[model samples]
Target: MSISPIAEPFYADARPIGPDGRRIGVLLSHGFTGCPASMVPWGRHLAGLGYAVAVPRLPGHGTSWQELNKCRWADWYGEIQRAFDKLTANCDQVVVGGLSMGGGLALRLAADRGRDVAGIVLVNPAVHTERKDVLALPVLQHVIPSLPGIANDIKKPGVEEHGYDRTPLKAARSMLAGWKQVRADLPKVTSPLLMFRSAEDHVVDPSSGQIILTSVSSRDLTERILEDSFHVATLDNDAPMIFEESAEFVRRVTGP
Candidate 1:
């Protein structure tokens, strides 16, 4: 009926911090089946650097997989769009980024907003899935509520993403639908782009990143390979790399 009390402890919602003079805003989203816990560190890092930051908890996330099943990709994208609007309301510019499904949502934002979104950064963003099982989701979701989870795919041993343990088929299908929309509009994402892909991501395939790199019309594009992480690289060994480099990337794009 509600979010598990166990997950309550792991839920985090962070907002912008620092001086008003900092005119740059950063909006980040968590992966599918994931809550804000995976991105709190990154959001806090950007906030510490004086950029306004927002990491919103998507609808149906951090609550229950059954609740997530009730949510459509449009619901998730609506939350990101709201957060982005809030960020751009005050800040002179905004940079959007996310992990996994969040990344696809960010891409959608970049495509929709274009010049409004100053830049794009993604870590193991999932735009497409080659899994045959995903093909069965259309029917499986009608019969089964959930399957095995795709959350917390980290290389770090003690770290946890604090996401849903059971993957909701209906919600997964919504994500795939969102991915198709984002991919179709790839040429519309013309902002400067930076992406990091784990060498051994188990959740999103490497081809996901490839499709993005080859499709986006952004004049500036950069790709980095993470040698020491997995799909949830934000919470793993290469987290610092993402934080540091992403901070620099924001500064580079938003300017002094």
Candidate 2:
């Protein structure tokens, strides 16, 4: 399958003189079945500020939904881990961010890597869902390959998220299962955290935000509610707010 131009991964190198004479890196990831296109604007905004930024296209994403069905949660996490390693190698400090499942992946990274992650910024991150249908996934995945997609949930008109039109069942099951482990290791995520959530998100319910805020051990935690957007707030009316506030968060956490 030919990759769409918008789906391509985005990268920006750290400048020699970054925040306080130290290079700062930001690793951003897209959600399940969603491509890097959703994060490119945010990545570019950070890069323009001289931050090394990497937004990786996860395995089975930016491609066909059938390919996504063949992948597991670990496969996506491996890609995020790889990008983090490379970004950290080139910068003195690193902060990780993600949207939806990508946020879950960032939490896993912070949990496993410890203080190496300077901070975390998440937007409508999903660690769990209140949808009862998920209980049928283990059996349904064997019976079906996919369901209708839950992408492009932005309230803004004409804003495309470039996510798969179908939600692969096998992959969905894997993501939900991985949430258990993330929840268990939440205490290991001790880095400063910032999260932005749309008050009217139709995709992720409030339970997800509640779980993260109550579970993570980060002492410096801030949660901001977005009133003018939906699930994909990164590209919606509140995007500028997310970008500017997040950039400020980066400076405060990575500053000497």
Candidate 3:
């Protein structure tokens, strides 16, 4: 008997930049259960600057919540590693960035790859939980699964006030496990990092940002607080700043 596929259909769309072929590729990873749709604009902006950009849809994303529930951190990290490898092959240098859980993955990649990665840009990375219920759980994660739900905290411009819109409990549990793993491995990240935090973020704990700054070994670390946005600062008032800062950081790291 033939076996069935384990993953859902997903895509990685690439956009090129510049005339001299001096492209600096950037790999963008989206938040948990979020598709590339959220990071498309950032990729486009980078592409406009003569850099190749790749945004990969993580495993179990852009599909039903059930698929997300079946995914683990390693699965998601594998997809990101593939995307990073592809970018490295196409460009002279590569930078990695992500939102929320994706940020955790980015940090993990930068840590593992060492100097191969040019830099990192993180927006509202979830390093620790302020949620008492989630932090209290021990073996309950393996016993019960949670459904995906709307994000209660978002400050994107002109977007409706909505939450994640789906709350896959099992997926969240797995992601939490991944976050813990990444947290343990933070000291390994040596690349220059730019961490952006939202002052009004209601979802992720504000201290998570500080933890990242203190944990990474990157001497060129820069931290910015977005006062007008929430957790999804990439699409909010701070987006332009993010775009500018990210481009600037990549330029600084890769040289003129």
Candidate 4:
């Protein structure tokens, strides 16, 4: 598959001058149907601050929606796991962050990695949905191939997420199933967590945030509400705040 130039994966390795004199790494993932375009800017910002950063293009993403339909949750998670492994091998400390479904993937990594994940930052993470339509996905996926697009839910005038124009049902079903597993393992996530949620999100509902806040065992947890952004807060009006605050969070959590 020919990937779009803007949606290409991004990675940068930098030497660290932290208190412990150890390299710090940040691994970021984009949402379902969304490509690395949604995360490359944030990764570049962190890289500018002299941190090693990686934003990987998940399998079946950065291509067509029909290609995405052929993928399952494991395919995406495997790519994230590979990226995380690479980051950990090069850095003394690693932090994970994500947007939307990427957030769920981050949480799953935190849960599985335990203390290896120094911290986590989430923007409009989606783990559960209140939509009743999801209940019929199993039956609907066989009848139809997709639904309307859920990408680019940003309030910024000209910003584009560069995500799929259609939501593939088979892929959606796999993602929803993955969410259940992430939710079940939430108690295992003990790393510091900073979550940025949009006050008026059109994609993921508030229940996802609520579920995460109430379930995770992280002692250092913070949630910031983006009043002006939508589901894709990472590229919206409040993106600067997310970037700065997340950088601060990473510094504090990975410091000696």
Q: Write the candidate numbers in order of decreasing TM-score.
A: 4, 2, 1, 3
Question: What would the per-residue lDDT of candidate 4 be over residues 1-256, giving only the tens digit for each residue?
Answer: 9998988999999677655678999999999999999998899999999899999999999889999999999999999999999999999899999999999999999999999999999999999999998999999999999999999888999889999999999999999999999999999999999999999999999999999999999999999999999999888899999999999999899888
Summed over model 1, clashes come to 0
- C-alpha TM-score for every candidate: 0.93, 0.98, 0.87, 0.99
Q: Report the lDDT of model 3 for residue 64.
A: 62
Off by over 4 Å in 3: 1-21, 136-144, 147-152, 160-164
Q: What does the lDDT come to for candidate 3? A: 0.77
Q: For residues 1-256, could you state the per-residue lDDT of candidate 3 as single tens digits?
A: 2212222222343344445446678888888866676677777787777777888878777666667778888999999999888888877888899998889999989888999999999998977887778764455656666644645356654653222466677678778888877888889889989888888877778767877888888888988888888877777778899999899888888774
Where model 4 places Cα greater than 4 Å from the true spot, the runs are: none
Q: Regarding lDDT, does 1 or 3 come out ahead?
A: 1
Candidate models: Cα lDDT each: 0.87, 0.95, 0.77, 0.95
For residue 98, give model 2's deviation from the true position in Å: 0.3
Kindly provide the TM-score of model 1 when superposed on the true structure, using C-alpha atoms.
Answer: 0.93
* lDDT string, candidate 2, 1-256, tens digits: 6777889999999875543578999999999989999999999999999899999999999889998899999999999999999998889999999999999999999999999999999999999999999999999999989999999999899999989899999999999999989988998999999999999998899999999999999999999999999999999999999999999999999988
For model 1, residues 185-223, the per-residue Cα lDDT tens digits are 999999999999999989998889989999999999999
